[model samples]
Target: MPRWEPDARTRLEKAALELFAERGYDGTTVADIAERAGLMKRSFFRYFPDKREALFGGTPLLVGHLEQYVTEAPPGIRPWPLLVDALTGTARFFPEDRETARTRHRVVTANPELREREVLKTATLDDLLRDLLTARGTPPRQAAYLVRLALTMYEQAFTHWLTPADPEPDFTECVATAVGDLERVLGEWGDGG
Candidate 1:
């Protein structure tokens, strides 16, 4: 066995997922996760604050990747496409391990706490994204709205892509479909009137 319980974070996350699926969120304990990981209880704390965190611990990894993607965009590129590319980066992150992704979706959807944590993470991420857009010359109010819209599209695209019955799964295409759907929904009031 490796000293210091290497990759303690990933190990804890995996162990927590298995326990949560088996015992349900409220029923699982930190010590239980640490034990399953063959780690000391203190090591679990070094990784996550509590069992609830493991439910959506991958969130920070996603946010950091998004920030990196946004920061790398050519200076003049606007926020929407930047947002799309960031969401697309997950195409690599996901489908990397389909079984893991499927199990994650199932766990997140099944538990109310997990779902709420996911939503909170989204809201926090939107705030950070909007800040970056504003830094890139977007006006504050518009930056906020645009980030919110892009994130909504990204979210719907993810759901569509991950739905087990999806006939043609593709988040990028789903994003375009979501944007088109939004346009149609809002275009009803127009005639350019």
Candidate 2:
């Protein structure tokens, strides 16, 4: 068996999204993707199961990198900070191809099929994050809560990044700011916490 090549997967993703934008996902086919990628149709099938996955090509890779980098973060680091780091570091995973990113975002947002995968991926990462926090010595209950909050912060961060008026950051600073706000709220509500 051959090792997976980032170059190959990236090519497929770029090709798939381009064609989908030009002719709609329903209008595209695997052959179109392969031709766009400048790859053989056989090679395309070797990498992705079908056309839709070409559009979703990088997600599993993104999730794996997040889990690995985040879980490996030093135990001394607080979980929220660790999450911010992980999300930030994972930024490069998406590529600087703005048109591709924006187009893929629109396709994923608009497509029922892609939305289901995105939601499931979120759920899976949330569970993984809770586990990572607990292993870092957060109380199990606290870890679960913190993971949910951090994910919510990430969501806010993503929304802010998408706003046309907002500044561009590889990873949104607003995410960490949201976390700080949450911390302030928790401190104010302290049951001697």
Candidate 3:
């Protein structure tokens, strides 16, 4: 058999996910993941702080991309469109491997600990989004509302993108659709619907 030859981080992440799937997240340890990956325990720490991070470690990079997009958006763009632009810019990180994405989603969803961590990560991203918007001179109250709306839209788009039934839209299209839905809902609500 050809040897599995992913890089150290990829190898560790793969091993962690496999172990998490086979033995449950709490049942798997960092050492176990490192051993499975054919590396030492310390090597695992070099890539991820702990097992949970192996799954969610990409958040900071994504948040950074969103912040950059917001920071560089053209002056006077409306809050909703700016938020959409930032979200769409971060779509680069969404995996094209649908099955792998689905598996990770299942693994995260199935574990309470992982779900809690996911919530924390989402909250962190929300804070970052609000801060970025405020730095761009968006009013604080508007930024707060926009932060929640943007995160809700992102979650909807991500969940839709991960489902295997339909031919999935491009990540940006998913974001656009979510934003459009939010706009329509807001319009209807404003009209007393």
Candidate 4:
């Protein structure tokens, strides 16, 4: 039997990111990631099905969290505010260390396949959020609009939060700022314009 290892999943993730940054995703293998993390290759499979999962393995958990947040929101809360709260709350799911997150972002953005995987993940989240909102009595059109806008805010916030050295603005704060920006833009457009 293999000895239990503490934080093996985190170690594998860090090692995979480092390797992906250094060798490019296509050049990095599961064996390389395991060796870099000082674990067996089988251990990698234990946590992830393949190399791509090193970057995207959290999508399911994230989706579950979002679904739960949307479904459990107060009955009086409107879709837009609920979405803002959900997006801001999701900041907890990401790593606090910005540099590590930046490196992972760089690795993913540099690879077309990884980028496509990312887009697909976003689409999956979009579908899930839309369905959750519609199920909760929000009109289908309103649900789709609010979800897409919220996702755009999330994307903007994520991009801002990844800025190289200026880390004062945390993820939640970034999301808030994105929401503010959206509100400002929409307000400027006015109700009848």
Highest TM-score: which candidate? 4
lDDT of 1 by residue, 28-50 (tens): 88899999999988888887887
Ordered list by lDDT, greatest first: 4, 3, 1, 2
**Candidate 2, residues 144-176: lDDT per residue as tens digits?**
887787777777676665555534654556566
Give candidate 4 misplaced runs (Cα > 4 Å).
1-3, 165-167, 190-193
TM-score of each: 0.85, 0.80, 0.91, 0.92
Q: How well does candidate 2 match the true structure, expressed as C-alpha RMSD?
A: 4.2
lDDT winner: 4
Q: Is candidate 2 or candidate 4 better by TM-score?
A: 4
**Clash pairs for candidate 4:** none
Cα deviation at 63, candidate 1, in Å, is 2.2
Consecutive 10-residue window with the lowest summed lDDT within model 3: 1-10
lDDT (CA) for every model shown?
0.80, 0.76, 0.84, 0.88
Q: TM-score-based ranking, best first?
A: 4, 3, 1, 2
Looking at model 2, residue 96 earns an lDDT score of 72
